[model samples]
Target: MALSEITTRLTAAAQAHGRDASGITLIAVSKVQPAERVEAVLTEGHRVFGENRVQEAQGRWPAFQEQFGGIDLHLIGPLQSNKVRQAVEMFSAIHTVDRPKLAKKLADLAQERGTCPDLFIQVNTGEEPQKAGCLPSEADGFISDALAMDLPIKGLMCIPPIEEEPTLHFALLAKIARRNGLEGLSMGMSSDFEKAIAQGATHIRVGSAIFGERVPG
Candidate 1:
């Protein structure tokens, strides 16, 4: 589908949930998508995008930025400690900060570089052992730690277990955000973004639905 169509649907979905569509940010997840596909969306004037890998983003975004100024790029996947400096420099937002070590590194880097992207602590709401987020129970402490370091934490983020009801996870994330006095809730994807909107998601990351299915490497 085209960017316009996806955006129109997103706006309608948000409105159906009594949300102001203008308040929601649409992140076109461009991980693993070729540059041409990203360019297609850029051509449609879609500026916010999400990327999974720092290396991949480093390879693609500089060129895209040269052509399209004012683009917002969010890093939405697992982040390695060693890559914290580069990640801080590249992304406009970092959405997978789930541990104290990573949070501290980001804080230090931001202090050194004098630039910090908005931060979101990813919560493993499902308590999935293999996932990359911090346990839901540990989120409060983690957020506290990040804040103590003066990290620019915006809110919480989560990826619900694929087989479970996503709304439940979305609600949990919303509750977490509210309890912590946060305003940004980076939950939802192509499959359940509308439900997420109803649950108060401020940022919805949609990839396949907008750029088509990923081409397997």
Candidate 2:
């Protein structure tokens, strides 16, 4: 689908929930996509983008940002401690911060480098053993620890189990954010973004619906 079509649908979805569309950020998940496809979206004037890998973004975004100013890049994947500095420098937001060690690393880097992207603690709302997030039960303590360390945490993010109803997970994430005094909820994807919006998602990551299927390597 075209970017306009996606935006229209997103706006309608927000309106349907009695929420203002302008308050919702649409992050185009550009992971694994070629730079040409990214450029095409940039050409369409969509500025916010989500990338899952630091290396892939480092390989392409420097030039893309040089050519197309005002773009916001979000790192929406698991981050390693070793890459904290680079991720802090490159992304406008880091949405998968799920542990104390990584959160402390980001805080130290922010102090040293004087740049800190918005942070979102990823919660494994469904308690999936394989997922990259803190368990739902640990979210409050983790958010407190991040705040004590001066990490610029702004919200909570979660990837619901594909087999479960996503609305339940989205609601859980929103609740976690609220209990911890967070305002941003980075839940939702191409499959059920409208439901996410209804559940108070401030940012929705959509990829395939707008860019089509990923080309298998």
Candidate 3:
């Protein structure tokens, strides 16, 4: 699928749910894609992109930026504490702050630099043991702690268990965001972004649907 088609669908999804499509930001997940594919999207005027690995982004984006002046990058994968500084410097947003220690590290970086990317608290809505988000039970306190640090927390993010009904998880995430006064919901991907928008997703991360599947290295 092309970027325009995916964008049109996202817009339609937002409209169908009484949302302004313009309010939702589509992040092109560019991790592991060929440079030509990414450059093609940039040529089409896509500014928002997501990268899973800080090291990969460090090696990739600089040259791309030299070529395309405005790129809004996001970190949509698990973040290690040691990588926080690089992630902070590189991404326009960080969507995987799942623990107090990670949050504290981000807070300290924001303090030292006087600027930080917009943040989203990752909630393990499905209680998936192997996933990277904070458990649902731990989210409230975690969000509270982040707020106290004056972090630029924009909203919440979640990746539903692949086999479950995503609507249930999306609704749960929405409920959590509402209570916490968060408007940004960084959910959804190539397969179910429409559903995410229907549940009030302010940002949807779409990758393979746009760039095609990655060739595993």
Candidate 4:
């Protein structure tokens, strides 16, 4: 599907949920997609994009930025402590800051570089042990730790369990954001972004719906 079509879908989804489409930001998840494809989306007037890995984004972003100014990059995958510097360097916002250690590392790197990117605390709403985010119960503590750092704490993010209804997770995220006084909720994808919009998602990261399947690296 074309970029506009996906955006249209996202807009429609937002409206269906009685949301103001203008209030929600759609981040085209461009992980593993080439620079050419990213440029295509930029040409289509998409300023926000999400990537899962720091290295892959680092490899692709400079070229895209050269052609399109003001591109906002969101790191939508797990971040290692070592990659905190790279994540701080590349992403405009780091969406998967799940633990206190990674958050502190990012804060330290940002302090050294004098640029702290916006941060979203990742919440494993499903409480999955295999996932990267902090469980919902542990989220407040992590958020407390992150708030003490320099990174601008924007909000929360989560990937709901694939087998269950997403609304449950979305509601949980909303509750957490409300309790924490955070406004940004980065959730949803091609499959459930509409549901997310219905439940107050501020940012939706969509990949396959816009860019299609990953092109082999």
Candidate 5:
């Protein structure tokens, strides 16, 4: 499908979910997509994007910024504790903060540099052992730990298991966010974004639907 058609579908889905299209931000996942495609979306006036790898985001963001002035880049995948400093520097927001070690590293980096990007704790909503998020039961403690630092804790994020119904996962994240006083829920993607919007997803990461299948890396 074309980019314009994708945008229209996204808008329609937002509307069908009883959500104002403006309320939710569609962060085009630009992981393996080339800069030209990203530029195409920018030409369509998409200012926010999500990327899975910090290195990938770092490599592409500079040119995108040069051309687009300042696009909002979100780190939407597992963030290694070792790369916290660079991750803190490159992206506008980090959505995969899953452990206290990484959190502390981000906090320390922020203290040294006097800045840290918006932070979102990634929760293992699906309890997938292979995933890179903290389990749901430990959310409050982790959020509290991150909050104690001077860095801003904006909200929570999760990637539900691909095979399951997303509403259950979205609802779980929403519940945790509410309990922790978090306002942002970065859930949903190409397939279940409307369901996400209905459940109060502030940020939706869309890839295949927006950019089409990625060019193989």
Candidate 6:
């Protein structure tokens, strides 16, 4: 589908859910997609995008930013402590902040830089061991710890197990966010975004639906 069609679908979903379409951020997931495809979406005036890796984004977005300003680049993948500085420099938001160690590192960097991108605590609602999120039980304590360091905790993010119902996870994420007074919910992806929108997703990541199948990076 083209960018417009995907956007139309996103808007329709939001409206169907009784949400104002403009309030929902449609994040174009550009990870592993070809540069031409990403540029094509940008050419269509899309400014918000998500990248799965810091290095890949560093290599891909700089030129795009130079050509098209006001791009909001989000780091939507696992983050390594060693790469935080570079990631902090390039991405506008980090959605996979799931541990105290990483949160402390980000807090330190934010203190030194006097500014940092908004953060979303990734929650492993499915409790999948291989996944990159804090467990559901750990979310409140984690949020407390991160906020104690003055980290800008925007909201909660989650990736439901591929085999399970996504709305259950979305509801879990929204519940965690609500109790913590978080307003942003960066949940949902290409397949289950409409469900996410219904559950109050503030940001939805869509990639292959906008750009065709990604070229492996």
- Where does model 1 exceed 4 Å of error? none
Error of 6 at 107 (Å): 0.6
| Candidate 4 lDDT over residue span 19-127, tens digit each | 7889898899988887677778888888998988888888888977887889998899888887877788788888898887787787778778887888899999998
lDDT per model vs. reference:
0.91, 0.92, 0.93, 0.87, 0.87, 0.93
**Predicted candidate 6 versus true structure: per-residue lDDT over 38-97, tens digit per residue:** 888899899999999998898888888999999999999999999999999998899999
Instruction: Give the C-alpha lDDT of model 1.
Output: 0.91
Candidates' TM-scores?
A: 0.97, 0.98, 0.98, 0.94, 0.93, 0.98
Model 2 off-target regions past 4 Å?
A: none
Q: For model 5, what is the error of residue 61's alpha carbon versus the real structure, in angstroms, after optimal superposition?
A: 1.8
lDDT of 1 at 201: 90
**Positional deviation of residue 182's Cα in model 3 after best superposition, in angstroms:** 0.9
Q: Tens digit of lDDT per residue, candidate 2, span 44-155?
A: 8999999998998999899989999999999998998888888988999999999888988888888998879999999999998889999999999999999998888989
Q: What's the alpha carbon RMSD for model 1?
A: 0.9
- lDDT score, residue 161, model 4? 94
Decide which is better by TM-score, 3 or 4: 3
Which model is ahead, 1 or 5, in terms of lDDT? 1
Residue pairs clashing in model 2 are none
Whole-model lDDT, model 6: 0.93
Worst 10 residues of 4 by lDDT: 1-10
lDDT of 4: 0.87
lDDT tens digits, residues 1-217, model 5?
Answer: 3667766766887788777778777788989997788889888787888888888887888877888786888999888877787888788899998988888888888889888899889999999999989999999999998999866999999999999999999999999999989999999888888788889998888898888888988
Q: Give the count of colliding residue pairs in each prediction.
A: 0, 0, 0, 0, 0, 0
